[model samples]
Target: MAPANSSAAAQRVIGFIRRTQAPRQSPPPACPPVKKYKSLTEIMAKARYAVVERDDYSDVLCDQCGSGERPDELLLCDKCDKGFHMKCVRPIVVRVPIGSWLCPKCSGEKRVRSFSQKKIIDFFQIQKCADLKNKCSSTQDAKKRKRRTSLILHKKRRRLLPFIPADNPSRRLKQMGSLASALTALHMEFSDDLTYSPEMAPRSANHADFENGGMQVLSREDIETLEHCRAMGRRGECSPLMVVYDSCEGYTVEADGPIKDMTFIAEYTGDVDYIKNRENDDCDSLMTLLLATDPAKSLVICPDKRGNIARFINGINNHTQEGRKKQNCKCVRYNVNGECRVFLVATRDISKGERLYYDYNGYEHEYPTHHFV
Candidate 1:
């Protein structure tokens, strides 16, 4: 009876499980909708650490003008990719550049050109004051102006002192004053004094007749070139080169003794007389300076009729051929843009108020010893 009862209970439990178990239904459609959890990549992308780039680009700010670029228009440098205001460009870029655009800093070339332009303007302005000071010397008002101008000049001079050669910096002013005194004491004849004479002719040293010869007129280009020389001297910017009358040296050029090499003393650009078969004896004219010469290359430059202050440059007679007493400046020829340009270059360190002289002839021969001193 116990075994039958246990079997009945097991059947009942099995029947109950079978009744509770539901029949299996058909599989759901392949495209059935379901709630989906985000993938690892998608979740990380949504996280704050993920870098997501937007479609819209922010406007760039100009480095020079310090202005942000407009959404519609902006100039970008092809090299540095720095944006710049179109109007802020030097020379003011009006139209969009056809090709690659470069900012002032990115271009690198404009800075130098800009600096040179600025320096030239400053030089001319400085010269205008200097000229006024010299002209207004007769009046009391002029005296006051001179004093003010001197103060301005003194500051510039102090700055330029380092470049100038002076044993005693304090005594440089005194020495310059003495040099001026010495030069003033010497009343040398100036080329400007020469007057036109219809029947003038070149004569010997004893009876030189500069008046008889017709004045050599310079071309428009030559006049413009000389203007540059005038600015250099009057501006007192680079070399303290000045034309002064020296009793012993005659009319000569002098530097404020600046420790400068290859300093442009003066630009000798005028009617360059190119002589192919020219001899040294051919240089009979008093003002003809030998510009450059090789075995076959003989180029002479005569600045008598059309020259800058270079025409007034006197020669230092190095009679002894001693290196110590040689001239301070040299005549150099440069090939510029396929054109030969002549310039007076400082050869060595020059002292303040020192007379600048160059050898007329390359060799140290005393051919014109009588004319020198």
Candidate 2:
């Protein structure tokens, strides 16, 4: 009876131990099934817990001079709340203007119209429309259907194409600054569009100045839009961009607002000279306008003395991932009006305050960008 009691007690104790350990030995409740994320943005959205709002202004300083002196004289940007001294800003605001004023950065953003609202057309289309209008008469009933079909086709092709400059004269002057004066002193004229000199023109009647096989011809609608842009450009209006002086990168162009992919930013404007003449040139912003089959006929654009916002744009270091990530714009050589033209175009959607960077060497990878940031 004593042995039986002892065996039963031992069995009871073992059973109790097994019951307590059963929960721990199980498979961790199957781990609640891991979530699969489709994109980095989704993961970021999930990881974010809360947002902290900033209400402090004790550390405000002038964005231009980096000084907080004469706080009353500092003009706070209505959009960004960044402070800037009246004298430090371009054009030197003598007194506050009548209405709401935006800083250079904010003003740039406001100047750019949304891509959805803007029209992009081809140069050839304008010529076709003008030719048709000159040839067609109001009595030609048969041509009406053809014209209607053409108009419909053009309407279908309408899309957000490129940037339009601001119409405000004061703002335009401020953006151009002393660039014209500097160019004039160097015997160069500031041009916002490509110019063809006698040397840069096609040498022979059969010699083609540009390769247009891959490009699309512009429609009449596109021509009207281009004309409007040209008129604005002639008035010293520029793309919705701001040139900010960086201590490290010198001067860099920044997008004032969101920009869509393939949006035409600016034409690389300068004196078109033979490549042979500029082979030993020290100009860092030289752009290849044409690479003719004949080496002697090749032309390059020298933007050292006269250029628009494109000259200030920095190149990206394609070797590093960080450097490549910084690139938002691309340099594309387009054939416009039987002439080779270089244009800076947006490669991806660019956000406000982001600096523009493009591959300087393009596919050839000739230019060294090791020190590019």
Candidate 3:
């Protein structure tokens, strides 16, 4: 220890000695230095759970914009109760359809009072108006003229009621909205027509274009081939299916009415094998069936006459309930002398040697055209 009062130079040397004697801490562990992600999307990718799907995954994507379409960050409108993105909102106006602006935070008693006193319609009110209109149209009561005319006041009810019965849950407005949305989504899909692979089907696609009048019929040979081949048929080792020709277009035969009486349908050969055994098969190499000309326009097997293959074998029935009810196909021909008919399903255009295809369950209800097999 220095004397009671040390000199300034001596005091400075003592302070330096004390500072050097202080305990040193272990150096802290270094975290791997954070590598910066390149893009804004990459930086915010962790928030994927919060993001909405802008379009279906398989839809054609915009290279610059990533997966999203005309989508924006979600925003709830204060006035209209309508859903729109933050970017889609229109400019502020003096008056909106549903009345004065009030966000969820601002939905106080005063806002509710303003909403009610004003004549603006709500989402539920629209539904009510729709229901009233439907009731007037269905009842068709001239004496109740007010019900027909007062659609606007009951707009919500009228909109809900038009297409089908209320008891049928499937007919509900929400379900229809979902269906419309789904159909709109389908429009985004790249169609087979737009995305054809030429290497895989050059001649075939061109031929279809020609035959369907999407292009000119290429030649007279093509027309002749179309008609001859249009008369399609099938042979059978398992099921004998004769697609007798007929036409039932531009008309819907009533539920109880006769299926045969309706215009055009093909006739079948009354042969027992054709009536009970023709199976529908589509292997291209071996069996070739020929179309027969007769009161019963039938099909034939080229190689054996003894069937090399089968014809139709599905739910579509051979004939009308009045004519025949063959399991697999019972007797297509009820009367030995009279004609028996078989209707065909035209999924594809039948060319020569391509086995003629038909359904066994019933007529081609899916395609509005049905003529005799």
The whole-model lDDT of each prediction reads 0.45, 0.61, 0.26
Q: Tell me the deviation in Å of residue 152 in model 3.
A: 55
Per-residue CA lDDT of model 2 for 95-124, tens digit only, reads 656655678777773222211111211201
In the predicted model 2, the residue pairs found to clash are: 121-222, 122-218, 125-218
Models ranked on TM-score: 2, 1, 3
Tens digits of per-residue lDDT, candidate 3, 1-373, equal: 5674578778899999988998987889989999787866554443332332344333333232233344333333333333333222221111233433433333442212212211212211222324676445534532233353256346643211111113332223332232222222222211101122333222222222121112112233222222222221110001111221111111111111111111112233111222012444221111111122331322222111111112212232344552232222221211111212222222322222222333332321322212233
Off by over 4 Å in 2: 1-160, 164-173, 178-189, 196-225, 235-237
lDDT of 1 by residue, 57-98 (tens): 364666665666453345666655566666555434545778
Q: Candidate 2 vs candidate 3: which has greater lDDT?
A: 2
Error of 3 at 343 (Å): 8.2
For all the candidates, what are their Cα RMSDs to the real structure?
24.7, 23.2, 24.2
TM-score of predicted structure 3: 0.19
Candidate whose lDDT is highest: 2
Error of 3 at 158 (Å): 47
**TM-score for all models, in order of appearance:** 0.33, 0.50, 0.19
